[model samples]
Target: MELIIAAGIIGLALGAIGAVIALRTAKSGTIREADNKVKSAHAEAEQVVSEARRTAETLKKEALLEAKEEIIKNRQAAEADDKQRKIEIHNLENRVMQREESLDRRNDALDKREHQLSSQQGNLDRRSRELEDLYQRQTAELERISDLTREDAHKELLDTVRSEVTHEAAAIIRESEQQVRAESQKTAQEIISLAIQRCASDHTAEITVTSVHIPSDDLKGRIIGREGRNIRTFEQVSGVNLVIDDTPETVVLSSFDPVRRETARVALENLIADGRIHPARIEEMYQKAASLVEQRVQEAGEQAAFDCGIHELHPELVKTLGALRYRTSFGQNVLRHSIEVAELCAIMAEELKVDARLAKRAGLLHDLGKAIDHEIEGPHAVIGADLARRHGERPVIVHAIEAHHGDIEPNTVLDVLVQAADAISASRPGARRESAENYIKRLEKLEKIANGHEGVERTYAMQAGREVHVMVQPDKISDAASTVLAHDIARQIEEEMEYPGQVRVVVIRESRATDIAK
Candidate 1:
């Protein structure tokens, strides 16, 4: 029994130990599974942090790129605006500069005018004092010499007034006649205006230089030639100057004579084409060119006469008319002006029922002397009259040409027509394109010359400086003094002023004596 009991205890201990071992084995397996779960969670957290960092880095890079683009855009916009402002400021400066220059010119003119006025005032005051002293002396002398009283003088003045009543009646009749003459004057104005309106002609201006273009700069040395002999020959033959400058394949020909200039142009063109430049070739080409120019001149003359319907002009007169093509007056073509004057004269003569053909002929040849005035002396009008006379023209026509400028005084209707036509042709708008400064200077000079004379109350330069009228005080100047003043003023104007045609001087004086009966 005891053995059995001990065996039983051992079996129990063995069973308990087996149970403990199984439990310990199951505990170990649980620890291993927990460790595996912890490791998986750590790895997942690391992966999430890495993905967030990558997203942050991409956002930072995008923001930087956007900032750089915005900066570049703003800079471009600011630069464009700045450029625009600068351009505006520069333009404004230019306009302001122009206005300042104009104002300066105006101020200078004002100063000059003020100085002239001050001088005139001083002269007038001194003259007035002298006249007052002279009048006082004259009055005293008369009072001392006369044996008559105031009552006798009054009675004599009444007698003189009674005797002047008949003359006053004639004056009233003259006033009535002037009132009736308005219709005739109106008709005359209509005719003149009609003549001006019907005439239309173009004016051409000529310069003293011509330019020749070459294909290359290599031709410049050839034109000058070796040792400059070719250039000298060209100058002597053509009577023109060869201006070889650094203007790049260009040569300028300068001459006072248009015919010679035209010849040189043609000849130079030929020589440049022929490529043979020498003294001998130059002379030969110049001769041919001159012949060509002569032929062109004749053709031009014939065309001019045909256009004017004037067929019977002398050949010499025709040639002179052609020469006028090269001449300019105040930037107006002389030949064209002559043609316009002729047309105007014919129109006016037709309206006035006069000889239109004779008027046209005289008008066309009126400025003939201008063609050779440089080679002759005396006035153009007088020289032209002599030319017409020598060319077998009618005496009346020659007189018309001379009298057109009033050098000989207009005696016939044709003379008056020529004068009127010439004035209209020259004074029209755009006919004489004189600069504004020159025009102002001419007017100022006219006033200056008139102010120089004594016994002049006031002076006015009228008709675009074509006439100057002087008014003299009656107390300071008598009628005879007025006539002398007119002559003196005219002579002074002739000596001092440079103008075209003629200027008429009119001096007017009026005396008034007023008495109140009351």
Candidate 2:
């Protein structure tokens, strides 16, 4: 039994060993399968990772391109904005510069005005000091020299000044009418009145436009030929406007210059009278008209001088004097005015014991400059004076002519007499028509100019702006100051005014003391 049992145990151990080997083989197969699966998964994961890397690279490139494009666009926009800002800044700078320049000009003007005011103030102060010193000396001398009190001397001085001024002014008037009142009161006026009545002239004033009467309106078409050439040629030759319109039986001639108007009128009238209207014919007629007008002017000039009982004037001067016939001053015929003034001057010179013949000659030639004033510049008086001097006139007559309007100071009685006669002629009631607004403005300006001075208390413009009366505060203005003030005012008026006549500036300084018996 022991042999059999040992054999069975050996068989059992063999079986056990076999079973262990089988188990090991199955576990090895499972591990191999797991390894193969894990390797395949690793390969798949590698492929996925490679594709993802390619996609990431492509995306990165696209993003980089977009970012670059964005950077470029931002840069361009920033550059454009910078350029616009620069332009605006430049414009603002220019505007600022212009404003600064304007302010600088204004400042310069202000500085100049201040300088002028300061200079005037300095002159006024110096004058005041000098006047004060003179007054002190005069007061001391008066007190030492006279037994009369200051009030008595002051009254006597005022009386003496009044009497002297009145006497000198009245005596200068040469009241011939007053002197001849007993025998022939109208003798002095009769001379001028008779001259006016003797010399009969057409009172019709020449107009800028003159009417040309034609035979019929059909003639207008001939006057204005094909393409308006005839009219153009006529105007070119005549130097005037020819108006061809619906007006019946007439044509019009227009020009601003009176002499030109007169010439054109005569030219047109001759063309009408001849009835041969063409450019060549118009030219011929115009020349003839000019010659005719010149002859007429010469006749008128010679007759004017002869009628005034004056002779020996320059031939050119006589012609110019004759030209005044076409000139009108304030609706009074300049030629007529001149003749009247000459006659009046002759009478006044006879009364004043002056050169009557010289006075009449000067008066006739006084307005000679007016003939050519339209062609020249400057005052008529100054121009006439120059003409007279150029034509070898006497120095006294030349001076009298120049000083007739107070352009120069009157140095002789003849000068004064001429001035008076000119004033009388120019200032007749209907001689001039001053616009009311102009008159008021002139009066206001005269007052304003006088009031511009220091120490003036009140200012009055009187005698239709011929005189300025300034009343100064006695305490502020001295006797010498009054005189200087008058002179200054007169000078300022002359510098600024366009008045036809001289202005008399009178400054009054009154000092009155009163003791009431209350």
Candidate 3:
């Protein structure tokens, strides 16, 4: 019986161990399910956070888009405001213009009415005066025939005659003539003053030579060339005098024709730059220089014509006009003088109510004769007129050309204006040059005159001999005497010498009376 109990205990232990293993496996499966649930909850939380972030980003994007739209809308509104303002401004300007035009029209109408009223009033006054004169004449004729008392009749007749034949008739005639003359003189003064003031250009003398400063004296030998062959060839080709004088590093190119001188100058500068002094180079430069001078001349002529409001000149005329760039008359450049005269004539013609176009044309062509005067024999005016006539200038233009110098009768006011303007330009102060000798002579004459005056001790020519300052003996000459001496000197200068502008005479009386102690 004990052996059977041991076998029962072993069987119970094996069954108990198998039940514990089954229970442990079920608990492990439950823990795995809980872990899976926790993982699912974490995933859901992450998904919610991501959706919130996306919504926030989308909201921010929408806000930004609205902000941009607002900015654009504001900008568009501002642009619209500006556009509306501009339109309003334009409308206001138009209204202002319309108002001004209406005002101008009303003023014109009022002026017209006033002029008509004035004319009618003048006509009525004239008719009333004529009727009174006729009635007085009838009464005078009746009184002369019916004389009652001789003395009374005579007194009555004298009173009637005195009223009829008063000084008022002569006074009226004189007043009318004076008004006409004053009007004419006033108009003339206005025209002349306007012309002068408008064209008041500073005049300068002309020269045919240009001095080119060389880099050094060494450049001179190169220009002279080997045995002076280069210089000879240059002169032959350019027709300019190359004056290599004592002047160091400087050479003078002289020619009567400034164009030729300029051509030579440019060619020389080019040759010096190239440093190749040869006959071939000289020829090449000469040809180029000739072409350039021609071009410059053409440009000068075109510029002059444009500035003077003259257009459409013939090619030959243009070329000839350019030649004037080299020509000068009485210390004033011919080209510049022509332009000034043309402008002055235009101004005068306008003020005088004459043909401005014709005046300018005549003025411009006035000096055309000077271009060929060196080559021609007769007076420049006649020669220029002949040349213009050949070139198919109008008869009026030709006449003006001849008449500007007072050589012929000027039929048109254009001719007179040109003449007057030319005279004004030429006769202006400092327009021409006086020789040094002549200037010195004038100064000496002025000094001698001042010295000849009583109580005058010494004299000096001041202000380029324009003013004479006389130092008089103060002991002999009073202040009043100094003034008298000044006037006398001025009178002497005026009478004895023909000077430019005017000369001012000044008398200075300075005295020194000293007694040295012995």
**Candidate 2, superposed: residue stretches over 4 Å from native:** 1-204, 207-221, 243-252, 433-518
lDDT of 3 by residue, 1-518 (tens): 33444455455445544544454456775756655555554565556556555666777788899999999999999999999999999999999999999999999999999999999999999999999999888777766788454567788889777655444544554567589888797887787777778887876687767798888899888888899988899999998899887798899998877678878988998888888889999999889988988899999989988888888777777777888887887678888888888898888878767888888888888988888786788898999899888888889988988998878888888788778878877767667676789778878988988888778888999877778888888887766555556767778777787655457777787766799898
Error of 3 at 195 (Å): 1.8
Candidate 2 structure quality by residue, lDDT tens digits, 1-518: 33444455455555555544555566765756656655555565556556555666777789899999999999999999999999999999999999999999999999999999999999999999999999988987878888676889889999889767655544543354246675664764665455445433444445447788888888899889878988998889878898988889988888655566677789877777788888889889889888888888889889999899888889988888878877777656788778877876777777668898988887877887788787889888889999989999999889988888778998987787677677667765456565699889999999999999999999999988889899999987766556667777988998998776568898999988989897
TM-score of 1: 0.54
Model 3's alpha-carbon lDDT is 0.80
- Looking at candidate 3, the ten consecutive residues that score lowest on lDDT are 1-10
* Number of clashes found in candidate 3: 0
lDDT of model 1 at residue 463?
84
TM-score of model 2 vs. true structure? 0.49
Evaluate residue 513 in candidate 2 and report its C-alpha lDDT on the 0 to 100 scale.
91
What is the TM-score of each predicted model, taking all chains together?
Answer: 0.54, 0.49, 0.51
lDDT of 1 at 271: 95
Of the candidates shown, which would achieve the greatest lDDT relative to the real structure? 1
lDDT of all predictions, in order shown? 0.82, 0.78, 0.80
What is the TM-score (0 to 1) of candidate 3?
Answer: 0.51
Which is superior by TM-score, 1 or 3?
1
Pick by lDDT: 2 or 3, better one? 3
